[model samples]
Target: MTEPMTDLPCTARVPADVEAPDRILWGLTARQIAILAAAAAIAYLLWRAIGDRVPLAVTAAVLVPVAGAAAVLALGRRDGLPLDAWLLAAVRYRRRPRLAVPTEPVEPSGWGPVSERRPLPAVLRLPATAIDDDGSIAVPDTGSVALVVATTVNVDLRTGPEQAAIVGAYGRWLNSLTGPVQVVVSTQRVDLSSQATRIADAAHELPHPALADAALDYAAFLDELAEHRDPLGRTVTVACVAPAGARGEAVRRAEHTAASLTAVGCRSAVLDAATATAVVTAAVDPFAPTDASWPRTPPNDPVTAARSS
Candidate 1:
C-alpha cells in the first residue's frame, strides 16, 4: 500500500523566446513579412522602370546588391534589436545633444559682460519632475510612481505545495496590475569598512579577553576581505506607475505589491520618501555617498558653508 501524496506543484517548461514575436507565415513575423514584401515590391518597380533600357546582366548586378541588402536589413538583428531599429537608434544617438544643464532657465541680463564665443546650455528635462513626501515620484505629463523593495523567494528550498503557493501569489499580483509596473533587480559593491570599524571599536566592550580577541580578529578579517576582494549586495525593487493626479493610487499599489510579495515568503515594503530618494540617488550615482537628510536639496541651490558644531 502507498501513502497519499501530500503536495503537488504544477510546473510548466517556459521557452527562452517566450517574448519573441509570433510568426504569421513561413516562420516569419508580421513585421518581417511586411519588410520582405516592401523590399520585393521596390525591386519589382525598379525592374519594370529600367528593364527595357538596361542590359539584363547590368540590371541584375544593380538590383541584386540592393535587394540583398534590403533582405539582410529585414532579417538581421543587432544587440537584441532589429538591424533597422539599431540603425535608427544609432542615427538618433548621433543627433542627440551631448551636453545639457538643469531645467531651471536663468534670464540673461544685458548688463553682464558679453561673451559671444560661449554656447548657451540646453535644458535637461527628465520625465520625473518631483518626488512627493509619501514616496510617489511625480512625472510632468505622465503619472506618479511608487517604489516597493522586495526580497526574492527561493523556490528550490520550498516544498512542492509551497512553491506552487508562491507562484500563485506572484501570478495574482501580476494579474491585478492595472497600470505599468517595473521590477528592477540591481547589484552593487558592498563596503564593509564601516562594519569592520564598528566591530573593532566594540571589541573592547566584550568583557572577556578571548571574546575581545575574537572580535578583533573577525574585524581584521572583514577589513582584509574588503581590501582584497570586491563584495557585492543585491536589491530588488518594484515601481508601480499610476496615472496623473493619482499619487495615492500609486502608493496603494506599492503597498498591495508588498503585501502580495509577503505571502510568497518574501520580505517587502513600500519605500518612504527619504528611502525612495536615497534609492534613486544610489541608482543615478552608485559611487556617490548619499546620507542626506529628508527633503532632498535642489540641484540649482547655491552651496553655503554651515557653522561648525
Candidate 2:
C-alpha cells in the first residue's frame, strides 16, 4: 500500500571525475596504452638484434609483441586479477609472505580462502554443488550451501543507543556461527524499476478518491525524480556457507541469521533461486535487466507479499 509514495534514489555516489574511467591516451586506458607501447619497444629491440637476417627480423617483429601481450594477459587472467589488480595483489602478498602457501585439504575442495598467487576465475567461484527449490545454493563438495542472500539493516536514522544495541546483537550472531559465512556488500544502482512498479500497484488498490489522487501525484513525482536523479540505496547480503551436509542444517543457520537480523531492527529473509539470480545478475551487469530474469510486476505491496511468500 505504501508503494505509490516511494522515493527514487541515486546510487554510485562517487564524484563524476573519480567515477569516470581514465583515458590513458586517445581513447586508451593507461593499462592498454602502456602495454601497447612496451610491446612496440620490445618488437623494435628484437628486430635490431636480428638485423641483416631479413626474414628472421620480420618474424621477430611479429612474434615478440604477440608473445609479450599473450604472456602478460595469461598471467593476469590466471591470477584472477588481470594486470593492474594482479600487480596490486602481488605487492600485498609480498607484504605478508605466508599467504603464498597452499590451503590444506585443497585441490578438489574448492573451499576456503583464495590463495595469494593462484589463478582465480573472473567470476567468484560458487562451489555450487546443488540447488534447492527454496533457492539455496548448495555445495556438496564441502557439505555447504552458498550464496544465500539476505537483506540489509538501516541504522543510520536510529538513535545512538538503538544503533549500539543493534550492532551488539549482530556481533553476537557472528560470534555464534559454527562454520564459514560470507557477507558481501556491493554498490549497485538503486532498483528504480521495482520502486516505480510498487508505487503504481499501491495506487491501483486505493479506493479512497482523495488518497488515490494523492498517490497519482506522488507517482508523477517519482517519474520526474527518475528523469532527473535518484538517491543511493544500501543493499546488504548475508551469505551462509560451509554448513553441514544436511539440508535442514542450512535452513537452521539461515533462520538463526534472519532472527538475529530481525532483533537488530532489520527485515531479513533467505532468498530463493529467482531472487538470488537477480541479485547475482545485477552484480555482474547492473544495466541489463532481462525479461525472464526480472520478475513481472502488477504493483503489489512488497512487505505483504514478502510475508505471504
Residues 58-139, candidate 1: write the lDDT tens digits: 8899799888888888899999999888999999988777778887656678888976745456789877777777888887
Off by over 4 Å in 1: 1-10, 13-19, 103-121, 194-225, 287-309
Candidate 1 weakest lDDT stretch, 10 residues: 289-298
- Residue 85 error, candidate 1, Å: 0.9
**Model 2 alpha-carbon miss at residue 72, Å:** 18
Clashing pairs in 2: 3-199, 4-199, 9-230, 9-231, 10-230, 10-231, 10-232, 78-119, 135-273, 201-299
The number of clashing residue pairs in each candidate reads: 0, 10
**lDDT per residue as tens, model 2, 1-309:** 566533323222224554445775677666666667776677667667665567875776677667777457533553444576677778887765343332333354556565665542232344454456555666657665534445566666766666667767877887799877767776555655556666777987888978988877887776677678854555677777655556667666777888887877777877666666566556656555332225322112132354554
Q: Pick by TM-score: which candidate is best?
A: 1
- Considering summed lDDT, which 10 consecutive residues are worst modelled in model 2? 295-304
lDDT to native, each model = 0.82, 0.62
